[model samples]
Target: MPQAVRTAIVGTGHRAQLFTEGLAKRDGYDVVALCDPNSVRMAFHNRMLLAAGRRTAHLWPPARYDEMLRVERVELVVVTSVDATHDRYIEAALRAGVRVICEKPITTDAVKAQSILDTVRETGGSLSVAYNYRFNPVHRRVRQLLADGAIGTVHSVHFEWMLDVSHGADYFRRWHRDKSNSGGLMVHKASHHFDLVNWWLGAEPHTVYARGQLAFYGPGPEHGYARDYVRAHGSSAADDDPFALQLADNATMRDLYLDAEGEDGYYRDRNVFAPGVSIEDDMAVLVSYDTGATMTYHLTAYSPAEGYRVMFNGSGGRLELNVEESTFTSITLRPLWSEPVDHTVDHEHEGHGGADPRVLAALLDGEQTEGAEVADARQAALALVTGLAANRSFETGLPVRTADILKL
Candidate 1:
């Protein structure tokens, strides 16, 4: 039997739990230590581990991450930290000669992203950005169809992603409301969609133009929402607000976020319509790919539904995929001039349409099923730069070249 890969998770947030719990069920991967600034969050994760029938991992503060890595002899570091902090941990792990599996977006801005790319180039460290969307069975099938020339030479793509009040409001209520922390939804959320386009088309972005606005979740009476307390918990004003997420309502949320709030002062339930939120809730982007393919994508967080519709226009035919998360419609794929086919997407596992488990298996157990895509630092950097350039376009109202932003 192969030796188990000793791993350390840098963040103990909700996303980190997916990897930790999934790793517990898999062989040849042992989560040895957890690194987070908040001890309470770490404790919650420890309790989660115990519930999963796995041994509790040693906890280390973020300041002692390097020491924890050295002492634990961690072979791989999984970075599920904040968007702005990903580059720091990634670069440090590379400098320490440890492998890394970082979550999507890689980093919030171009400078940090470029730094990570430089570190990867300098150290030749193993780094994989976890774009788990590519691991979804239906999405993998889409990749397979594209690879098989079912769509022929792709010329253009149109993607629209909608996040309903439940999911979309969550972003506004957290650190993601600040562009400094999350680089807006364009960088933080659209990275996944942009990467899917890059991966499916087998190309990189060349130019990007975008427009965005904070129409939904910022301070403005124009949005038609009355003023209220900042957080939902213990607030009478938020008691009747459907958009407010009561962290105390869900045990998992209560334990993970509400209980940990005292240590970090991080409230899980902030008013989505409160002032000081910097991120946009609506955005549209136009991208030109190196393969001569053009893409028009829009992301709206304050939507009535949560799902996406992506259409690929190719030389031979067009392939369209429609997915609605909260409905019974499932995933439907249609090729132009053919009957629309319904694909029963498996939601048996948690996280992003069952992509998390497959991603974890690939990252930890070296299990690469057919059609699974692994994005390296370079690929991740390209995807991130696309979004960053889009954001710049949104600000400057000019088409921004990915190369100019990347300085490549």
Candidate 2:
């Protein structure tokens, strides 16, 4: 066996747990440090590390990131920080001659994305974005089917994602509700869907047009959801509100956010309908691809249930994927002038339909299975810029070209 890769993860939030737990359970990775603004959150992760039978990692403040890299002899940095902050850490790691495995979107806005693009070209460094949806067995089969021409000469795509109240309301209560921090859901969430379309068609985006609004969340009587309370932790108004998240009930949320609030003043259970939300709850986007294909996509953050529907139209036939989250999933092929066929996909493991482990293996151990290839920084940028174009369109009421956002 080769030497272990000394790794450190930035940000000690919920997402960071995936890397910490995955690294602890796997070989070829020695998680040496946790960098974040809150020492309380870092210490929480340290306890988790001990529970997994791994040695505790050194906790470093965000200000001392570079020093941690040098002192710990870190070779890889897993970035799961705030969306807008991704570029800062990525640039720093690349500059320090360290490899990076970043969570999706790469960065929130246009300028940060361009900076990352420039830095990657300048340093000739290694940066992989974890678009784990691509590793889901069902999605990988779709990629294979598309490549094998099961859907020949793809022309159009339609994708609609629905987030149920329980899952969707959480976003409204968290840091993601801020547009500046997360670039709205279009950047923070829909980038995953955009990347899926880009990868499935093996094409890049051409033009994008979008319209979005905060239809349900935020403090406005018009929304019919806002409670008078700012947060749910100590408010009687939030006790009866269905949209409110009770963080004190869950051990992780309670320990990670409620108990750690004094260190960072970040609340995990804010009122979903209270004021200060800048992100949209409903979004629609239209995109044209470099391969002469077009896609119509919609995302609803206030649905009664969770699931998504994606369809592909091609000269040879049409293919459809309907997933009711963890409940039901179906893939159908309807070839022109032929009988319709159904394809079944079985999930092999837990966590995002078994995508998490596969991605962890690829990122940490450099293990690449057929149909489960990792994404490069350029691909990450393409995904990010596509969302950026949609966001620009949402503001300007005009179609924005992907090429204009960031030069790839």
Candidate 3:
């Protein structure tokens, strides 16, 4: 039998905790170390793992990827740091002869992305971006349906994702407010959505046209409710706020976001109508895929509920996926309220229709099933570049083709 793979995490952020916690709960894997710039987050992960009855992992001083790999001898590295810094850790892991499972969008810049890919070629280290939505059961069903011609030759798509005021406001309130770090959600947040579209269509993006703006969340009307003033709403020196993290006061908010604030000063509970926020609360785009299918996409910050509605129009028939609620059940740095609804399906798991668990399963245990479609690094890179191109188009008031931007 093959031995369990020893893995370490580079960033102790929210996604990093989710990945680590999932690893701690599952078998056939060993959690070796946790590294974060913040000692608080590192200690939090250590405590969480210890309480889970697992051995504590070695904690690095911070984002010291070189130091951790050199000393801990980790075989697999997971990169969940901020969007712009994904390439740094990924490149480091690959150079150290370690395979990597990194978060999506690779990086904000295309030129730098090509350099990382080039290094992966030289080092021969495998890399997989964690676009877990492709593993989702409902989404998996959608992909299969599209492949089986349940949705014949997908002609066009209309996908709308709206995060209500509460959820949308948090992006601007936190570190994500900076486009440089978070890539303004186009790359950070929409990468999941874009990857889903890529997987469902089983086609590469050909062209894209988009437009968006900071429609709300900055200098907006104070909508009668108290802000989750977690340290004066983005002041550099604000400590973690106990009131905002009060799970008893708001169960959903606590579980989805409050628990994960140890790693960063960013708060998941900012006021939806707070002043001085910078990220865009609204975005819209139109994409043309290589297979002659076009997709219409829209995202809004202020919505009544979270989740997505995807409608696929094909030559033979049409299919639709209505989530009706957010899939995120646990709160970390972001306060999430997963709506409770009994989904009647044969398969069930947690996170994005259980895609999260399945992804880890496949990664650790090797491919379990044949005929499962997997997106390669290049494909994932294309999706990120497509979203980035859309952001450029939105800014410049021009239509941009994905292939044109990618120069493919």
Score each candidate by Cα lDDT: 0.86, 0.89, 0.70
For model 3 the TM-score comes to 0.82
RMSD of each: 2.0, 1.3, 7.2
lDDT of 2 by residue, 95-148 (tens): 999999999879999999999989999999999999999899999988888899
Query: Which residue pairs overlap in candidate 2's backbone?
Result: none
In candidate 1, position 231 carries an lDDT of 88
**lDDT per residue (tens digit) for residues 168-199 in model 1:** 88899999999999999999999998888889
Better of 1 and 3 by TM-score: 1
The number of the candidate with the highest TM-score is 2
Q: What order do you get sorting by lDDT, best first? A: 2, 1, 3
* lDDT of predicted model 1: 0.86
Number of backbone collisions per candidate: 0, 0, 13
Quote the positional error of residue 374 for candidate 3 in Å: 4.8
lDDT of 3 at 401: 69
Q: Distance from true position, residue 251, model 2, in Å?
A: 0.8
Tens digit of per-residue lDDT, candidate 3, span 114-183: 7777877889888887777777676766676667675457889899887765566567666777777777
